[model samples]
Target: MARTATHSPARVDGPPAGPIEIDVRTRVFTWITDRVGVIAISRMSAEDLARARSRRLSHNVVTSRVFGPMPEDVSLTDLRIAGPDGPLTLRLYRPHGPLPAGRHPDEGLPVVVNFHGGGGSLGNLDQSDWLCAHVAARVGALVVSVDYRLAPEHPYPAARDDGYAALCWAVRHAEALGGRADRVAVMGDSAGGNLAAVVCLLAREAGPVIDAQVLLYPVVDLTFDAPSTTAFERGPMLTRADMDVFRTNYLGEGGDASDPFCSPLRAPDHRDLPPALVITAMVDPLHDDGVAYAERLRDAGVPTRHSDHARAVHGFICFPGVCRAAGEALAEICEELAARLA
Candidate 1:
C-alpha cells in the first residue's frame, strides 16, 4: 500500500484525513501472500475450492477476538426454524435481567433478524455471535442470526427464501423471543446485505412490516456495472475476479443475474420498502451499488440513509480489530437502529 495506493496503476481509496497505522505484524504474512499470487478459482477443482474457501472463511469469521468480548448482560441461544430448503439454524441474542419498570417479556422489544456475509456460503451463527450479542445488549433489542443455505449448493432464492422466512418467523414469534413484532428489521453484511436488500424488496409486495433495514457493504448489482466495480476491481478484499467466482457459485450455472432477488438494483419498484441504512466502505467495489440503490430508493419515495466509511475497507464491519473505523461504523449501526426502532 502506497498513499492512495496505486496497485499496478489502480488507484485505491485513500485513507481519510487521520492516522494510518499499517499492521507491521502482518507484513511478513503479506509478503508471503504476495509471492503466492492470487487464488485462481478458475483453475481449481470443486473440491479444492471448497477446502480453500472453508479455510479462508474459518480464518476470517468474526469472533470476540476481533470484536472484543460481548457484554455480560447478553445471552445467546442456538435454535432451529423452518427454512425453505429444510430446517434452518439460528442464534438468538437477548439481554438478561431487569427491563424497564413497566416492560414485560410478552410486551417484547425491537428485533433484528441478522444474516452473515461470506458470499452466503462461508458464514455461520458462531462467527457472527459477537455482533448479534452487541446489538442485543447495546440496543436493548432481541437479535436473531440466521444460518442460511450457501452457494454452489442451495443456490439463489434458497438463501433469499431462508432470509425472508427468518424475518417472518422473527416477527411471528417476536413475543416468545422477547422481540416486538411491530418493530423489526432485517440486517446483513456483504452478501448477507444483498439478502437483506432483496428480502426488503420481497417484503414490499405483501409481507410483515419491516421497521428498518441495515445493509453493511451490500452487493446490490449482480451485473457488476457500477463505477466502484471497476474502481475497486482489485479490491484489497473483494476483487473483481473473486466476485466473478462468488457470483457464479452463488447463482449456479445458467442462473439469471438480472433477477431483482439477485440484484436489488435491478428492481423496477423500490417504493414502500422500509427505511434503509446503507453503509459502505469507500474502498469496497460495492460502494457505488449502495449509492445508486440509495438514490433510486429516494426517487421511489423510500427513506434511505447512506454512510460511507472513507477509511474502512470491505468487510470492515466484521474485522473491527483490523480497523478503528470499523468500530465507529458498527457504533453508527447501533445508534441508527436504536433511533429508528424507538
Candidate 2:
C-alpha cells in the first residue's frame, strides 16, 4: 500500500533572520524570466492584463514540462459542477493501480480538494496538474483541483464560496468519486492557500469536517505588512507590487482586509480548525504570512507543522523541475496529509 509521511506536530517558527541564499537553479530561472519582461500585474496596462488573462486559460506546454512530468499512474478528468454563481470546472485525478488487499475500490481512498495558486487572479486547473496528480498517485488519494472563479471579474466570496461549495460537493459525492467522505483534506498554494485556509475556517463553523490543510507559501495576511513583505519586497518570483495587484483584484473597493476570511492570520480564534502543514519559502515576500499563521494555529491548540525552505523563492512548489526544495515540500505535504487522513 502506498503510504505518506506521518502527521507529527513539528514547530518551526519561521526562517532564520538573515539573507536567504536562493538555490542556484531558482536564481537562474528568475533571472531569465525577469529579463524576458515578465510583467507583474501591478505594472500591467489594460492590454497587458487582457493578454495575461487570455493566456491563463491553458498551461504553457514548455512550462508544464519544467514543472516536472505528470505521474503516469494518475488519470485526469474534468467535470463541471454547480458553483455558488454558476457552473465550476474541477479537474479530478485518480491513481490507477491494484487495490490493497481486502479494501474495496470505492471506500479506501482519501480525498484532497486542491486550489491552484495565481494570487486569485491568474491560473487554471491545468497549472495544478503537476501537484495534484502527484499527490493522488503517491498519497493514494483522489485529488480534485478547483477552477474557482477568478478576481477582477468574480471577486471575494465568489472564489471563497466556490471553494466551500466544492468541498461540500466532494463530501456529498465522495463514494461515487472513489473516495472516503470522512477522509477529506484541503490543499493549495499562494492565493489558493488563502482559499484553503479560509475554507477550513468556514468548515469549522459549517460542516464537512476537513481532516488536514496543506498551505504552500500562503498569503495568510493581506494587509501586506509582514516583515518578509518589506524584507523581500522585490522578490525573485513574487514582489510586493505584485501583491498589491492581487489584493486589489481580489478585494475590489471597500473590501475588508482585516476580515479573517481575507486574512486567515487575523482570525480571532484559530482554536478548532483542522491539522495544518504550512510550508514557507525564505526568499519570498509572503514568508512571514505563512509563518505567523502557523504560529497562530499552533498557539490556538491546533496541530500545526511548519517547514521553511531556506533556499527557495516564492511559488517554488510549482516548479519542482528547477526548485530542488519543491520535491521536498511535496513529500512533506503528502506525508502530513497521509498521517492526518489515515
Give per-residue CA lDDT, model 1, range 1-342, as digits (tens): 211111111122332445433354223333343345334344457786677556532223354455456678887888988887689988888888565445565567899999998776566665566677788887778899998988778888789999899999899998876678899888899898999999898887868899899988898889987767877676556678878888988898788889989999899888899888878777667877776776777777777776767656677776555556656767778877887888
Q: Each model's TM-score, in the order given?
A: 0.84, 0.91
Q: After superposition on all CA atoms, what RMSD does each candidate show versus the true structure?
A: 5.7, 3.7
Q: What does the lDDT read for residue 121 in candidate 1? A: 56
Q: Give candidate 2 misplaced runs (Cα > 4 Å).
A: 1-18, 37-39, 56-65, 98-106
Error of 1 at 33 (Å): 7.6
The weakest ten consecutive residues by lDDT in model 1 span 1-10
Which stretch of 10 consecutive residues in model 2 shows the poorest summed lDDT? 1-10
Off by over 4 Å in 1: 1-45, 48-67, 97-106
Q: Return the TM-score for candidate 2, rounded to 2 decimals.
A: 0.91
